[model samples]
Target: MHSSAVFLIEFGAIILGLGLLGRMAGRLKFSPIPLYLLAGLAFGEGGLLPLGASEEFVAIGAEIGVILLLLMLGLEYTATDLVTNLKTQYPAGLVDGALNALPGAAMALLLGWGPVAAVVLAGVTWISSSGVIAKVLGDLGRLGNRETPVVLSILVLEDLAMAVYLPIVTALLAGAGLAAGSVTLAIALGVAGLVLFVAVRYGRLISRFVSSDDPEKLLLVVLGLTLLVAGIAQQLQVSAAVGAFLVGIALSGEVAEGAHNLLSPLRDLFAAVFFVFFGLHTDPTSIPPVLLPALALAVVTAGTKIATGYWAARRNGISAKGSWRAGGTLVARGEFSIVIAGLAVSAGIEPSLGPLATAYVLILVVIGPLTARYTEPVASWVIARRRPSGPASAPEPQAAAEESGGAHDELADTVRHDR
Candidate 1:
């Protein structure tokens, strides 16, 4: 009974705090992610007051948060859309890997951590936080923007790539032989291909089976199915979030709309818990020793990620402003980075690697929303300032309007208009 009461008090206090923080963020017109992270830090190890009873529960909630995030994101499009994106965006995924992943691998080798650790660190830097980026897109009302599909396609490719990359990393860390690792890699690829094929081919049938008139029944069924598939995917060495995403794509029309409506509030609540749970694991005292290198790494990879996004979006014919937004949206590294680093940490690969990954993620995740909101406008402002100030130096006004992405600085104008 005493333990129950403490759990209630601790968890209740957390919810209440999150609600207030969300309200403050609303009034300030910004994301609540950084605030949520700080709150978790304050209540975690080596901070002000640690939660003794509810920490475990919070971790489970965090997993649910990620599943819901991906599921809802999937529901926004159809299987056809996913297939279309896959066809047009595969090259961008290659560019993304080369630009972002190499830096981390190079850094690891430069630090003399060897090839295995290099592979692990490469993964840590390559992937962006889908959950965080999804949330930012929703918060900033960019979900309907032209560049969003480009961003989502890149994220989906990364998740698919993880199916293969993770098994190799695990095999390496376990000191498994070459043949065993090859077998695992083969299985991972086969499963990933099967999932995508099934999702695209028979999705309508799945939706028909899941469709229901009653909201309560629909909610229970969809949520239950999502968790089930997510668990099975995790067991198969696939990304649970990707599994959830497949489930979402399999539903369409009324069923999809109903599931989204029923799940939105729950998604928001658990998503906050997820961010907090992330902070709880990071011991504040461990950050300073590797802060400089981490900051330097974060800076370099951030630029690479931005460039990757810009190139991908532009290749798909997105406007300059839309490409900038797409690039900025991909800047934050969250859950996947931590997960990769955590595996390395548990294997006792390199002590400094874990801390560096932590600090790198921390810096990028905080700056993510700011960049998403301002990158285009800031870039536009800078370009405008660089232009020579004279009628003769500038082209015709009509020509300028045609060149500046459908209007003269539409991105900046949108920001100013919003303000």
Candidate 2:
């Protein structure tokens, strides 16, 4: 077979395998991310499949995936949504961001990696996957709840932070030669900020043009704008994913109804390619003794975020139950984690670390959905136990209510009066 034909055949096979696994995963209530990573591992050097695709190409595809994912994520937000949620989102987001980086930094420092590597790793943990969480919640019929808007607000905040952090961290890891100086970096940041501001300010005008009843036109508009912003962000030394997300946020005010109709199908189609390509790139045999430490680090990476998310939500007046539910639901990592890992590779991090990161990612994708599922039960238990007792001057509502309206009358009437 011709080389191009051979590549296409191999790619098709990988996609087929992932689709089957993804279906099985959905039925079994597991996130397909872990399964994809496992698939990557299976085909990697030490595992079963061992297709020798260049990590560089896979990483490129992953970047596109990140950008597309962010674009879709942005589509879910609106200007009004941003304004309303900014208050609580800022603090919670900050805490989650800090929590993500600090733990990974500590772990990397302990492990004796370089400063740049430590920062990259720490920043990786800082992200929370709104896409994954929202999808899961929506599928489970939990998206319309009182807590969802607040959770989404925080997720948006994280996306903004990711915009700043991914680029800076990527530059740092790129080392001295690849580094953009403070002035250049500042200019890039300023330009991005301006673009976003203008986009938000005049979004209404753009919405009129892009917001069509036709799904195809709406998708074309979204894709065109997405690539435009992504291009701008790249020129400014930031990740295109950030550009896509900001554009999404800008459009959030008016994009949902029409844009959703347009893009959902595309997202589903491309999402499969993204995950399968993600699996194709990760080399399983490359992980070494440090694999053990990597898993431990992964646990801390996820745990710190969970704790911080809970703390932030509680601090913001969310009920303990709601806070726990939101925090746990946000714990799963997907598109963002892989994007950051790709950034690390672009910075010349060795293949060994990539495998370790994949191992770490495997755990997050596995645990995140399960954490979301059980959050309700756990939150309910916490809420029940923490209920305030009756005041000294008044009987407890529970006890009093039970006594006054107990099932006693009905049960007493039903029972025979035995002396």
Worst 10 residues of 1 by lDDT: 410-419
Task: Kindly report the root-mean-square deviation of model 2 from the true structure over all alpha carbons.
Answer: 9.7
Q: Rate the local accuracy (lDDT) of all candidates.
A: 0.77, 0.65
Alpha carbon lDDT at 2, candidate 2: 79
Q: Give lDDT: candidate 2, residue 417.
A: 16
Report how far off residue 347 is in candidate 2 (Å): 2.4
lDDT of 2: 0.65
What is the per-residue lDDT of model 1 for residues 1-419, given as tens digits with 9 covering 90 to 100?
99999999999999999999989977876557668777877887887898899999998998898788768766766666656656778899899999999999999998898999999999999999876787787677666566776787898778657656776787788776898777767776676567667767777677888988989889999999999998987675455766787777778778887898899889889878977876676667777987987888888988898899989978877767777878998999987787677667657878777668767877898888888888888877897799778674444343333223342232221111111
lDDT of 1 at 266: 91
